[model samples]
Target: MQIGITMFATDYAIPPQELAVEAEQRGYESLWFPEHSHIPTSRRSPWPGGPDLPKWYYDTYDPFLALSAAAVVTKTIRLGTGVCLVVQRDPIYCAKEVATLDRLSDGRFLFGIGGGWNAEEMEDHGTVFATRFKLMRERIEAMKEIWARSKPKYAGDLVKFDEMMQWPKPVQKPHPPIIVGGGFPHGARRAIAYSDGWMPIGGRGGDTLAMLPPFRQLLKEAGRPESEVPITIFGVGMDGDALKRARDAGVSRVVFGVPPEARDKVLPLLDKGAALMRDA
Candidate 1:
């Protein structure tokens, strides 16, 4: 299985280009950047990770701009958003950004998307918390249509657009891989329905690898091949046994979580990670 890295790029953390260059030189397969456009201070919506959210969540650099910088510095490493909040953005403009990034990166782009967790944050973007998942799905579908057609039009319950022309169609055929991120079954179903892949947080609530068999069963039920909807488990621990188990369970990629820290602190971990892989 391929190993990738995900980091929340911030002012105090290692810069995107430096990380990307180092990651590529170390033989890592890809680099993922997470984003939180703006965090509301209301504290009404609970943080998903724990009782207190990390400061970096509110300090994240824009994923598109960071990844674009990464793309310029590295050639082989694939660039991805760990989970872009599609429910909180305009699909038409987002589609153009995706295509431009893909073209500039020589077709190496992975579009990881999520419905978002913060209720207040979604509300700030003018999206209702109750219908965010539906809106996310509609946005994904609409973006796909935009990428694939010269003059595309889509009409969904949450998202609608008239036929319009857009330039710089993605270098990848049709579009980049859309990896939907969430918990099992539901995310798997959404992925099978429209997206190119599924990404579940590693060891969240339970071992997501255990859910793969049932997920595959769902794929069979939908008449889709197992290979099409690959799993990309995020926040993975650096353990050989766990990696082996994930591979056996048919996971295509495991994205290791990197702490957002200064260069001196972060570089050693990156070097050690590369060394560990070499030793393995």
Candidate 2:
């Protein structure tokens, strides 16, 4: 399994470019940045992670811009959007950003996407809260059409557009891998239906290791091979047993969540993770 790192990419953290270079130098396979356009201070919707959302969620720099900085600074480490909320953005503009980033990074982009959790946040973007899942699927489908065709158009219940042309087509043939993110079964099913990869938060419901076989079974039942739709589990802890279990479960990648902190604080963790990678 490929081991990597993910961070919130806040203004106070080790900047994305510096972290990318350091991660590459430490033999980390990839560097992932999470995105949240804006955090509403209303505190109406409960945070999925906990009672209080971290300040980094509101302070995050735009993932595309941060990853662009990372791309210019580093050559080998793969770039990723840990969980870009596609439901909250305009797909036409996002398609352009994805294509441009993929081109600039020389086909090194991994598009990890989600429907998001904050109801008020989605509402602020003019997206319906209850129907966000369908909207996300449609947006993803529309973006694929945009990436694959010279004059592309999509007519979905939620997302529709006339035939249009966009430049700087992604270097990755059909566009960057769309790694769908959500909870089990539903998210996994969406991945099988349309996305190129599956990204589930580890321990969201229970043990992530225990869930993979059932996920694979679901793929088999759908006539889709799990191998074709790779799994990348997020929030994996750095440990021998966890790593072993993740590998045994056939995970394509496991990303360790890092705190948005200074270089002095973050680099030591990267060193330890790289050491574990070597030991594993």
Candidate 3:
């Protein structure tokens, strides 16, 4: 199993490049960053994690920019968007960002994505909350065309475009791995339908271990090999037994969350995580 770290890059936190170098030196396999363009102050959409939404959601930097900074400074450690909100973005520009980042990182980009939960935030981007998942599927389909073909054209219910050329195709064979992030049957079905992998938060919906068998069964029912659609559990804290269970259960990767803080506050946590990685 692979071990990784994730943080919300913010104005006051440890700089992303510096954190990337630290993670790489400590032997972490990948680094992830989450994105939020702007939080709607209306507080209409309750945060899934808790009653009080953290400040990072409102203050986080763009994932592409933060990951790009990480990519240039690290040679081996992979860079990823923990979950880029594709539903709120234009596919053309988003595709270019993914491709450019992959090229810059020498094919080390992992595109973790999701249809986000903030209804008011999506409304600001002119996306209807109810149809966001459908829109996400179409946008990702359109982006895949942009990455793979010389002159890509897409005609879908929500997204339509004429044949047009985009530069800087991804360094990965067709494109970087698109890892769909969410929970249970719906997220797994989406992964089987289009994405390369599935990422479920460790304790959000249910215990990841409890969900693994059914997830694999769903993959089998869809005729997808278990190896093809790997499972990545995010926000797995430093639990040796849990790590062992995840590895034994055939989890492809486990990512631990790093609090958005200064170097002094973050490095010790990385040290503890690194030690856990060694043990796992």
Q: Quantify all predictions' global Cα lDDT against the true fold.
A: 0.89, 0.90, 0.93
List pairs with backbone clashes in candidate 2: none
Per-residue alpha-carbon lDDT of candidate 2 for residues 92-121, written as tens digits (9 for 90 to 100): 999999999998899999999999889988
TM-scores, all candidates, are: 0.97, 0.98, 0.99
Per TM-score, what order, best first? 3, 2, 1
Model 3 earns a TM-score of 0.99
Question: CA shift at 154, candidate 2, in angstroms?
Answer: 0.9
Once all C-alphas are superposed, what RMSD does model 1 give against the true structure? Answer: 1.1
Which candidate leads the pack in lDDT? 3
The list of candidate 1 runs beyond 4 A from truth reads: none
Of models 1 and 3, which has the larger lDDT?
3
| Candidate 2: worst-modelled 10 consecutive residues by lDDT | 235-244
Question: What's the CA error at residue 122 for candidate 2, in Å?
Answer: 0.6
Instruction: State residue 206's C-alpha deviation in candidate 3, in Å.
Output: 1.6
